[model samples]
Target: MEQLQVKLGEKAQITTVMQEVFATEVGAVYQCNKRNRLVVDFANAQIVLKVDAFLRLKKAVDSIDLRDMAVNTQRCSDYELLTVCGCEKLYVLTLPEIYSFKELLGGAKFALELNSMLHECLHTQVA
Candidate 1:
């Protein structure tokens, strides 16, 4: 995964993240007196999704517990497969290269931080 860049200002902060696997640009533009919005720029369209939508999605993903899940890691050809189960649904991810579990955990933590920041931005705007 590529690194996510966050810029904090006096009134608002911006987060810029790129999905290297796909043609997408996901960002959050936080400002005062307005709802914090999530901007998703695709190859052909620019979409502004409400931050609440992301919050809901984040809640669902955050509910997942790795401790209760079964993990199967294997290498097939040039890619690696990470299968996680034991939740309501099964998840299979194909990673182009091998990555440490710590790295994945760190990514999840970063996501949670991002969600918290977004939530706080919205709360500040509303208050």
Candidate 2:
């Protein structure tokens, strides 16, 4: 029917438009406002996460103690396991990789916050 065709057309038009937020040698982060999602491409994995989930992921990564990870002799300390509250994927990263991941997430968070501040400033009334 024509209604079905129209629905399909609308769905097609809802394409993801992504903007690069940050990048590093190990990974890159992108934001898609249309979907309100952050796409993190890291270590051969592409993770699509909601904005809140991305924040939680950043918090989790930031909580890791690099010094402890580096100094511990336990076999389990060889790799850090990270899991965000709402995200289903589990990330296992070695010390160096964890450091890179932390940097990537931190940079992305800063870029997104900066963009939000710019938008607010640009749109504010000149009162």
Candidate 3:
């Protein structure tokens, strides 16, 4: 658990504990082990997702063809719509926003995989 102190008033303060999985200039992903949830903060919005839902969100984001979407002249192609299984919020993003979002997700995915690998290697008992 990580503790952070925030000042709300002269006599008010608060603290929050979270493990940051990944982050970019535009957003970040945080893991709350105690709650078994991932908190995604992006585009001025925050979403709480379970592990499976986070994976699904990454898959959905990866499937989008940014190049095609950018080159296409269709009006609908100007923006992309994204939704993750078990998540209620719909993400409507423009080309640049999509790029940033993709970057954030990709970084988070890499971090998660690296953590898993490290955990496995550290816990394995070599005979």
Candidate 4:
């Protein structure tokens, strides 16, 4: 396994149709911050967000239904896009990048499961 320890204050270029900008540093797991946050590295950039924010992102990603899109566009030689809009910037992941993302999320499996359960509980309580 590769070393997953990402140091603080690392930066990566994030781009959109408009322009590209550097990512802002956020808290990482290696640090002692009790903010209920999950950190993932993409292209060497750290993406740190709270559990609630991550839950919202999960909702957005679910709404996209990439699997369905993949099935529909299987024959098309174009890359499918999944754009995640964070509070600071937008993260646009291509189909290949999505695979890396899946791996990163797998590292945070416990957090993902907990977030999913908490989300369901909140909805059930609300209803």
Candidate 5:
């Protein structure tokens, strides 16, 4: 079987979108700083996010679509990295991150719901 490898750059784009949406809704100023420096040579890999960047990413993911994650997506296993070779970059939600802030602020619920829909649409590109 071929390895499942996701491009670091694609993942970064998803993270960036999530971060922007979360920041806009929560009034939080979040910025995605490039933690891993990638190169054209896909074989030579040295890409990894620092602790702070990881935390920010986690928060952004959490804030994206908590409701859908709880009711709809499958939870991703606890792995430092997800490699999806032969498959393009995609957003896989883990359950715990899905239903965070069960009781949301005004308009926040809609934001999360929209994020969920957006995520599903993004997944369709892989096929």
Candidate 6:
């Protein structure tokens, strides 16, 4: 049940996000052609998640074409969340926007392979 809820707080722009979010990861985070979108790279999977809204981005998480993997979705007031398969614990990704999670990152171009890799690395660990 470990989830990272990044509230926009008082901020109103995308550029400011990199400063707050980048602190969590040293070099694994990257910004692309998109403004509010970001990529979290990990050993197992690279996660492409949009930081704008919770709902619209959730849809893109579903539309992401994946092979030989599992996906789960949940509905919340703030956002709709999704979790892809991991080596052990669930790999939880939350979209905290009020709109459909699909709308925010539909135009975003990234690798789903990165998504899976981020899921495995962030959510699982070897014992």
Looking at model 6, report the run of 10 residues with the lowest lDDT sum: 18-27
- Tell me each candidate's TM-score: 0.27, 0.84, 0.84, 0.45, 0.21, 0.23
| Model 2, global lDDT | 0.81
lDDT string, candidate 1, 52-115, tens digits: 5434433444444443333534333233223223112222322311222233333434655786
Q: After superposition, how far is residue 16 of candidate 4 from its true place, in Å?
A: 30
Q: What is the C-alpha lDDT of each candidate?
A: 0.37, 0.81, 0.81, 0.47, 0.34, 0.38
The residue-by-residue lDDT of candidate 3 on 1-127, one tens digit each, is 4443323235855455778899899998887766677778888787778888988988888889999998899999998899978766699999998889889988988998899898888889552
Candidate 4 residue 59 Cα shift, in angstroms, is 2.7
- Model 3 lDDT, full chain set: 0.81
Which segments of candidate 1 are over 4 A away from where they belong?
1-36, 40-48, 71-127
Residue-wise C-alpha lDDT for candidate 6, range 1-127, written one tens digit per residue: 1232232334642233332223122224444433454554432344544544322334447654432122433233223334533211133443322122233233232333466587799778752
* Model 3 lDDT-worst window of ten: 1-10
Error of 5 at 16 (Å): 30
Model 1, TM vs. native:
0.27
- Which residue pairs collide, candidate 3? none
TM-score of 3: 0.84
Candidate 3 lDDT score at position 45: 80
Count of residue pairs whose backbone atoms collide, per candidate: 0, 0, 0, 0, 7, 25
Residue-by-residue lDDT tens digits, candidate 5, 1-127: 2122324554442322213223222132222234332111112222234334434444554456444434553445321232333223233423442232222221343454586798899999876
